[model samples]
Target: MQVTLKNFTKTFDDTTVIDSMNLAVNDGEMLALLGPSGCGKSTTLFAICGIHRINGGQILFGDRDVSDVPSQKRNVGVVFQNYALYPHLTVFENIAFPLSVRGDSKPDIEREVRAIAALTHIEELLARRPAQLSGGQQQRVALARALVRKPDVLLLDEPLANLDAKLRLEMRSEIRRIQLETGITAILVTHDQVEAMSMCDRIAIMNKGEILQIATPTDMYRAPVNKFVAGFLGNPPIVMLEGRTSGDGRFLVKEGTSLPLPARLAGMPGDTPLSLGVRPEHFGAAGANRVEGTISFVEPQGRETLFDVTLDDGVVLRSIQPARDDVVFGQKVVWPLDAEKLLAFDVSGRAV
Candidate 1:
């Protein structure tokens, strides 16, 4: 199913939660709505599932408008954060519940339940109740139940948030596999950047009830539209520093630090106040066009070491290097900035 939201609007007592939000989940594509709490991601999901009514615009499943359809009639399967399984029901019974609700024959329900259980690898746990299952097991049961109905669309609301780190990783792969196998158009609402980037085909970055940018994981990382999108999508987060473009095609970082501006930015106005954004990995050993700084902190992260370096003007920046590199706190070091990889933003936060 290709689910489309056209000018979707949702409000509560004069407060708008989703303001003219428009998005589309392409057929069989797994899209993720990612943002912080109160960013309207969950609300947008609910609106699509008909749990929250929209104030304006249309909700289309393919070409048909289902904006006013009731939640139960939407044919959208939902797997919530808590699993929401019935504790008293066995896994088989729980998976069969959705089919049984619409008065399917006993034998047909049994056949569908078993098939879904097999697909989810929970066939052996058919007789077990929710309490007897581990968090991951319960999650699988929930997924099976959702798939048992063979919904055209699947909605996951932080479905793996309650699991442990290892379990979360496992479920991420599990969910992706199932979505691909079933070819269901799915939307996942999550705040975890890694989960979204790892699972979804495309990610919709949201903030303050509006979509900031929607793109493939690689594109969103390499070319964010603005400061918010750039800062929100990285693991350690992009380091941002105040700077200005000097008259001589140079980007001035601080009192005595500057690097030649890339030719692509030759048209930028001289003395333009800007924010310089760079990933930690973009800094390297001292060479041409490098700047000097004193290390303030060092953290060894298995394969890589993270260094907190402070410049002469009190500006601090982070750099990541191979763990084998000998680095010590309080020692002076120099690292060249990758001019081509540098991102520049105007005072308004728009990428320059």
Candidate 2:
């Protein structure tokens, strides 16, 4: 189903949680609503699922406005963060609850529940109670229950947050596989950037009750529309250096270090203050246009090593490189800057 939110607004008393937001989830697309906590991502999901009423605007499911539809009438399934499984219910009963509540026949409910249980790979645990199941198994049961109804849209609100790191990774792959296999439109709410990037077809970044940017993961990372989007999407985060353009194809950073500007930015007026963002991976071994610094800290992270390098002016920068055993503290190191990979933002935090 194609889900559309046009100028959707939700407010609590005098405070607004969603402000005239507009978005669309393509038919059969798995789009992630990604942002920090209290960013109104969950509120938006609730609005779509009819759990929260919108104070303004319209919501459409394939051209039919469902803004006034009741939660149970929307044909949407939600898998919440806590799983919400009943402690006394067996896996089979829990997965069959939705069908049973709707008055489906016994044979129909049994067939549907068993079919979805197999799809979620929880058929073997059908006889177990919620307390007897592991975290991952419980999660599968929740998903199976949600999918058994064959809802047009599936909503997952931080569904993997309770799992361990290994299980989270495994479930990420499982969710993606299920979404594809069933061809159901899915919306995932997550604060984890890695999860959003690795699982969804596209991501809609939200903040302060507003939609920031919506794009495929690659586009959102490679060409962020603004500084906030740039800084929020990366692991280790994007390093932002406050600087000013020299107008002579150079950028003068705060510490008095001048680096050449990209050709596209050559026309910027002289002394135009801006923020330069660079990812840690972009910093490499010394080469032409290298910046010199001394290693302040070295962290070996399996395949890569992270170095905290202090510049001559005492500004510390993080750089990621291949893990090396010979690196020592206080050792001078030089890293080259990739002009193409650098991002420039104006005082307003908009990408230049």
Candidate 3:
């Protein structure tokens, strides 16, 4: 189903949860609503599911307006954080519960349940109860249950939150595969930037009941609309340094280290204060542009090393190297900062 949220708003005793939020999920595409807790990501999902009443605006499913529809009638499949499975019920029964509720026949339910179980690769565990299965297996059962209904929309509320790191990675791929294979429009609510970036076609970054930016993961990462979005989306996070334009129209980072402003940015109004941002991975020793700093810390991650450098002006920046080095802490290094990889944000936090 193609879902649309137009000027949607929700309130709890005059405190608005979702304020004039507008977003659309194309048919068969997975849209991830990503943000930290109390940022209104889950509230938006609940508002769409009719669990929370809207104070204003419309929610549409295709051409129909379902803003006032009851939750039971929306034909939306929900997979909750806890898996919400019946302890006594076996996998087969759990997968068939939705069909049985709609009065599907036993033979038909069996066929549908088997199909979904096979699709989720849980066919062998059909006879096992919830307690007998691992967390990932239980998660698959929950997914199968939600899919058995063949609902118009699918809503996943942190469905993989309970799994371990390895399982979470595994399930992320599995969920993406299922979405592609079934061609079902899905809304995924997650706080994990990695999961959202890896699995969804587009991600909406939310904070304090508002969406900061919406774009494909690459755009959101490579070209964030503002400082908040830029700082919030990355893994080790983007390193930001206080910088300003010199009288000569050159961009000088900390310690009066002036670099010629890009020709394109020379048109910007004079006396603009800019914050320089650099991603850890973007720093390379091969680049001509170099920043002088002493290694404050080194974090080894097997395949890569994260080096935190304290510049001459007390600014700390992080850079990623291919692997751990013999360089000790407090060692001085001339790290290359790619000028093209640098991002600038104005005083208002908007990208410049």
Candidate 4:
């Protein structure tokens, strides 16, 4: 179903939680609302689900304005961060409870519950109570319960936050698989950039109750509309530097830093004030543009090493290199920058 929020606004007391926001979720497409804490991601979810009354605007579910509809009547299923399962009930019983509440017959409830259990790969744990299952299993049960209803739109609010690193990775794949197989329009609310980037079809980045940018994960990362979107989406984050354009329309970094601008930017005003940004992975060992710095720290990951280098101006920059490289902290190095990978932003943080 296509869900649309027009002129949406929400307020608590005198503070507005959601400004005049407008967004549309295309039919069958998964949209993730990503941001830092208290950015109103969950509030927007609840507003759509009819849990919170909107201060303004209309909400349409495929041409039907359901803004005034009650939460139970919205046909929306929500999975929360904590996996709010009924500890006293077995997994099968927990999954069956939602159906029972809707007045389904004994046989129908059992059949649907079993079907959902199989889909979530929790069939073997059906007879176990929540306490007896692992965190991932319990979350799966919660997911099964939510999906058993065949909801029009499934809303997940940091559903994997409680799991361990490995389990979170596993569940991300599992959730994406199930969502794809079911073809349900899902909205995921998460603060984790990795989770949003890895699993979401597209992401709506929010801040202080406003939508900053919305795009597919790749586009959002490769071409962020502004500094906030650029900084928010990437792991290790994008590095920024104070820089400016030269008189001949050439971009220049600090004294010891030199990075080419994209060929398309050759004609831009040379005196324009700008900031330089480049993703960690975009840093190279051989390129026409380079930055000289001393390694400040080395973070070793299994497959890559994160290099923190202090540039000439004392600005720390990050570079991701292969684990096989022998670069170490306190070592002087010249890191190359790919001109095409450079991002330029103005004083307001908007990309130029």
Q: Could you say which candidate leads in lDDT?
A: 2
Q: Which regions of candidate 2 are displaced past 4 Å?
A: 285-288
Looking at model 4, the pairs that clash are: none
Candidates in descending TM-score order: 2, 1, 3, 4
Best by TM-score: 2
Per-model TM-score versus the true fold: 0.97, 0.98, 0.96, 0.95
Off by over 4 Å in 4: 252-258
Model 1 Cα lDDT, one tens digit per residue, 43-124: 9999999999899989999998989989899899999999999998998999999999999999999899988988899989
Candidate 3, residue 109: Cα displacement in angstroms equals: 0.4
Which window of ten consecutive residues has the lowest lDDT sum in model 3? 255-264
Q: Between candidates 1 and 3, which one is better according to lDDT?
A: 1
lDDT of each: 0.89, 0.91, 0.88, 0.88
Would you give me the overall lDDT of model 2? 0.91
Error of 1 at 139 (Å): 0.9
TM-score between model 2 and native: 0.98
Q: Give one digit per residue, the lDDT tens place, for model 2 in 71-108.
A: 99999999989899988999999999999999999999
Count of residue pairs whose backbone atoms collide, per candidate: 0, 0, 0, 0
Tens-digit per-residue lDDT, 39-79, candidate 4: 99999999999989999999888898999999889999889
Of 1 and 3, the candidate ahead on TM-score is: 1
